[model samples]
Target: MLLRMPGVYRPQGDTRLLCAAFHDANLPPGGTVLDIGTGTGAVALTAARAGAASVTAVDIARRAVVTARANAWLSGLNVEVRQGDALTIAAGRRFDIVLANPPYVPSVVDVDARGPARAWEGGCDGRAVLDRLCAAARDLLTPGGTLLMVHSALCGTEESLIALRGLGLKAAVVSRAREPFGPVMRGRADALVRAGLLEPGDIDEELVVIRADRAITDH
Candidate 1:
């Protein structure tokens, strides 16, 4: 079991989807890994258990860092948990595999707002963090590297594919699962419907796992 602190994102369907996708990923022996927005280090621990050479998990929440670190210790997995912005922490480093399960729930809440909501609130369009991660994927990855990311279809899976392909990477959705709205999405259902992002009475969201790969010949 993983240890999650208050305010840290709980390991839900999206997290499970990402973990399952990671299992099917082409992780070379001794490949290095970076897990962005890792909450309880669940995905990071999975990589480590699979024998990744190194696993570094980053989250903006201090509580998450603590929780992840503790979980790593509890599980006897070697994961370097860091508390900082994902982009900033990933700067100057490249990994063979990048795993991301960032916030994708659209909301009027400020992306910078503090508190538990930060774990799932993804700004007005739900693309705030998604866009940033896509834009930075190339820089964070080594040539031939692959990124496995999970988010709600409400966040525009097509947009993510376009962004990665535009950056010269091969991108596609590799997994998907529909799930009933959780508390957060249930609360935003009306607003999303009013904004035309969702149909009236819609109470389910599709979670998708996208895989993007850098061509080995690129560099």
Candidate 2:
């Protein structure tokens, strides 16, 4: 079993969905892979298994970093784990592939709070971290590199596509799935109604996997 310390966001549907997306990406030989908001280094491990030359994972929570490191060791995978905001840690680095399953649940409270909540809360609009990544991702991608990210459609899948395209990447919804609302989404169902993101009785949210590629000509 993968090692998990308390407070780390456990791997779930979004993680599995992104894992499937990774199967479709064209990873370069001996390529470098970066997993943002990695919890227990699940995606990083998958990347290593897929033959990525090197894998690095970053998470904002200290517990998550520790848990991910432990899991990597237990799995006998060479994954570098670090603790920092996804955007900050990714700055000044370029990767052949970047993967993320960021915090997208619209929170009743602003997402600035630390603790277990930090793992999922993304403010009223739920794009707090995702938006930042769209803006900052180009700096972290080599020309022709790809970004594979997953999030709830409740967070505006179209918005993310538009943002990434605006940054000059070729972006599109590569895959989608409807999943039963998990604890966080279920608990915030009322607030989501108030936020106009859900209907009164909506019991599920669609998740989407988006792929964006930096053109080889971007250089």
TM-score, every prediction:
0.97, 0.96
How many clashing pairs in candidate 1? 0
Best by TM-score: 1
CA RMSD for every model?
A: 1.3, 1.3
Assess the local accuracy of residue 82 in candidate 2 as a C-alpha lDDT between 0 and 100: 90
What would you estimate as the lDDT of candidate 2?
Answer: 0.89
Write candidate 2's Cα lDDT for 1-219 as tens digits: 688888889888889999999988978899999999898899999999899999989998899999989888888889999998877877888999999988888876444557988888887788989899889878889999999999999889889999999999999999888999888788778878888899999999899999999999898
lDDT of 1 by residue, 1-219 (tens): 677777888898999999999999968999999999999899999999999999999998889999999999999888999988989988999999999999888985334557777788888889989999999999899999999999999889999999999999999999999988998888768888887799998879999999999999888
Lowest-sum lDDT 10-residue window in model 2: 105-114
lDDT of each: 0.91, 0.89
- lDDT winner: 1
Q: In model 1, where do residues sit more than 4 Å from their true spots?
A: 109-112
